[model samples]
Target chain A: MSKHTSMALRRPSRLSPDRLRVVVPILALLAMLVATGFLQPRVMSYFGFTLLLRYSLPLLFATMAQLCILVVGDIDLGIGPFVSLVNCIVASWLADQPWLCGIALVGAIFAYAAMGAFIQYRRLPSIVVTLGFSFIWLGAALLVRPTPGGTVPDWLIAATGFRTPLVPMPALLAIVVAFIAHHLIMRTAYGTVLRGIGSNAAAVERAGWSLLVGRALLYGAAGFCGVLAGLTLSGLNTTGDPWVGAQYTLLSIAGAIIGGAEFSGGIVSPIGAVFGAMIMLLSSSLLSFLNISTDWQLSLQGGLLTLVLALRTLSVWVGK
Target chain B: MKQIKFASASALALLMALGCHAAKADDASALKDTSKSGIALSNSYAGNTWRQQMLRVWQAAAQQAIDGHIIAKTKIVNADASAPQQASQIENLILEGWNSIVLDAASPTALNGSIEDACKQGITVVVFDSLATAPCAYKVAYDYVEAGRIPARFIVQQLHGKGNVLVVRGMPGTQVDVDEFQGAQEVFKENPGIKVVGTVNGQWTESVANKEVAGILPSLPKVDAVIGQGGDSVGTYQAFKAAGRPIPLITLGTRQEELALWEKLDKATPGGYATEASSSVPGVSSIAFWVAQQIVAGRKVPNVVKVSLLQISKADLATWLKVTPVGAVASPVYSKEWTIDLLKSIAANTAPPPSPGPTQNK
Candidate 1:
């Protein structure tokens, strides 16, 4: 009698499978907002949103970049320093010579594509290759601007720093980025092919798709988003720092996972990834506002991440 | 490959002959160099402007000493922020037989063993900003607590003992950050009417402070005063300006940009924004150099000597800015006699090194 009752309880509810993909992240975000609101009631206001979401643009772009790699069943460990290199390039080179900076940034995307081809042709693991490339990017950035001071271009700052009447610029940019990412990675036909390659590379190969070209395109797309992330960060700081984007590698991975992306499966939700990044930003700010020490804030962030992912896993298992 | 090898062999032989000739020349000139001392500066980090300025102070002071016939030469080994590299660099300095080793350590404890080894080898080890904890090393550091307290007291007095203040902190968990916050908090505790509205981590970088402070300015209600760590006041002031709020009284670091901004403020209005500035000063490193000179000169010195903080008022902003270049520190260099006097004063202030309590059992 107990087994029958438990089996009945475990049956999938009225919530559709499509809804399941984003529901957890959405709920986690709402819960984070409520928690933050409780700690600081002023956080419910528009001004608080501006403060809380000020740094979300770069993080959102970074998460989207990670999502591209995850969808290709390969992770780019180099995205962090790659972004830092782009930031350094923009802050100094672009600030001085906009035309030259534009060309260099475009050149970097081509380089990323070449990197993908090299990894594919050499049959190297992405983790090892990208990890090695990260050092190269870091070295290149240090060589370009050895210190943490260079002005970001005024045009880039003005563009990203624009504020809508009621909506904060960060929140507005996050929505636009999420919408574009969702359209490209979720709704397009080529997007399905990318996800399918992640799911079964052999099957995709048997279907007469050039795996090499597909991977290059995926990596190149990630490079494009990484550049955007870098630009956003430099714009926020009003300058470039070689060390700024290093922490974003792990953060992007965590955001992608918490947003309902899987490592083995080519499943991801772009809108959910943005929400995930916001949740991360809000959690730390909220913890700080609660007067928690910095040491505990880190552990608490890890704990929160683990709890959310564990809950999503439990929910998925129950539904299955 | 054969041609390359032949080329390299010829180059090597030529280089060896030239090296021998140079060695002979040095030997011939040894009489002139014999009276000068060799000092090595082993810097664990050299990435920031402050470290750069400190290096400049060391180089200038060392050059002055050389010209004055006090020291022969100076060698600076920049570890690029690596503690292990710094440890090995110190060992190299010891083996190189320098008369004195001036160290700006990366971590307080990581280099203690190397420093002790250097000390045991009859090398005078002088540790300055970001100091070493080795007991054998003589330390010259500014009073970091007072660096924080002076700013807090200035802010308190400016606000007439009651106003909302924001604290823009430096790198968290570092001793400088901890001491500064503690000292500021001590002053804040005394003044009950002064409420701390918020604290932001500026990391002692201008852009970081500017962006972080600007982000929170909307949520904060009328910040009357701002207390920030060194290397961040300009950015804090810029944040307030961007927010279209009147710049509150903020303590300036020794950065020349700050003094220039202070000058601008004075010109735009009068009296340099009516604020005060204080810093540990880049020239403090020169004082450390002077102390090393004293030690090499066989003058007994204290194990640790605390340099006092420097303050620049509104009236003196122009004078300070005139001497400091853009982006450099506005630190006053103490004369040789003044350094000796300062060291003597610090030695008298601290307790006498534990008298060997009636010979050990051995």
Candidate 2:
């Protein structure tokens, strides 16, 4: 074959770049699904889109929240406890008052935001402070809803979980959030400041933007998202179980890393984190259907995360 | 400089303003000095209403004047379930001069230091449901290991010494988990026929048990029964519903809950395990109150209290007497006053431990 002919044939396909990017992961997931189906088709149906969404939304919101912190290249261990703290608050106080839910919920979100701001101002390790904060808030939450029996109001749950006629509202909201995130992150000065600080806070320090302010804003935003997810789950169950928020801490971190977010400042995206959460949720539910052991579910999650990281690394290298 | 002056002047202004507030606080503290003493309650919610019930039970216990001993006041601090939070709360409460503590601690190990600290400060400590690493001034709650053994023995006999039985357990790394699973395992070791086919942590929630059971269904063989550790029994039932499968189910906690399952399984009556929900919390609360009494009176309390667990089937639901006394709005409300009164009684009694009662199956 002539070199020119070979080069012409190798030219990029007609598929849009964004479409191509989306299709690759979807196809990979399909292949995995088909393989699992051959092993047990029942497992496949149990973990379909809506079911996966049901499991993923909380973690998705959590990781999306974490993305704010990660974008600025800072870590906030407190989001985990923050999620639980807010959950306890909602579970105990507004649990019965469905009518006053909107006002109460909005007020709570502001309080959580203030907490995040305080942490940033203190310039303490988020892991330590958040961990401590978790105890305080959890203690406060339990002081109210000591037992685990209650149901979320119906409307909020519907708004969050419904997916008919092709668009899963949760995913759609995630996408909108992702786009808004992408714009704010890539287009705005705060986004640039975050990248700068994340990459080299020392350099950014000389660049004039306050690392403290960036961290506060990002973490506060992350916390707001965390509370949103907690509130959403509270709506799903209507009763707040205090321990519910604690589980998401590890799960959210796993989602963020698994979704292909890098350790460094420039590598995270809200969209990627959500996709990662969806995949992890789907995979776990599928495993549950397959009757895999809890130990294996964790090992598999770790394994999948490694595979995603490897693939991301390969993609970057090959593209370069 | 301006910020410091503004802050100090505001502080001075606030100090003068708060001087008036201090008068009220001093008067309030003075009034309580002789009549009412402060007590702190710490616990793990474990989804078992026992700890939650303590809040109410102690208040009731406090109401009883023991030999003209004015049972001044009580404060309830709960962790819901977190070990770390309870430890911190203990520290803060101690700093605030709470000299007596009743703990249904989150974990046995987590409470050791706090208990020791309380003891050092001349604070009387009472622990139950789970114990501190060290013995308390007094301890009262069901002997968890024995509780497991009673249920295990019956379930093993019903399983006919051999079958695949799933054990749905409570929180991991907890005293309840340690003691109950330990006792149950000892019994299982003796009976080779009883195999622990699967074990899952339901965190004592029905929904979790339901999901875990559903997750394991395809891999699980046809099983004889499930022995859920705590509240997750309901979820295990739900799992059976989700999986479209059924087997005889034996779970514990409340009588009504058990009967509820039997009712669902038999398709005969409304689910009412009259014994479990009605009796379990209040019974534990009764024991805690007794333990608290030992501390307040400067007397030794037994290391453990054991309540005979009742297995309520559909057959028994009809005449099931709710053990937790009746109160307004679920009248058998486990009140706090019972705990304080019970604590004083146990503390006052230094005699040999009384022989336990017959297994009352109501």
Best by DockQ: 2
CAPRI-style quality class for the chain A–B interface of candidate 2: incorrect
Model 2 chain A lowest lDDT segment of ten: A42-51
What is candidate 2's lDDT per residue for B304-356, written digit by digit as tens?
54343334444444444343222211113222343333433455653323222
DockQ of each: 0.02, 0.03
Best candidate according to lDDT: 1
Q: Which ten residues in a row have the lowest lDDT in candidate 1 chain B?
A: B353-362
Candidate 1, residue A4: lDDT: 85
Worst 10 residues of 2 chain B by lDDT: B326-335
Backbone N/Cα/C clashes per model? 1, 45
Q: Considering only chain A, what is the TM-score of each predicted structure?
A: 0.92, 0.78
* lDDT, model 1, position A211: 84
Please give the distance, in angstroms, between residue B191's alpha carbon in candidate 1 and its true position after superposition.
0.7
The candidate that wins on TM-score is 1
The reply for model 1, stretches above 4 Å from the true place, is A1-122, A125-320, B1-36, B270-272, B348-362
Model 1 pairs whose backbones collide = B37-B72
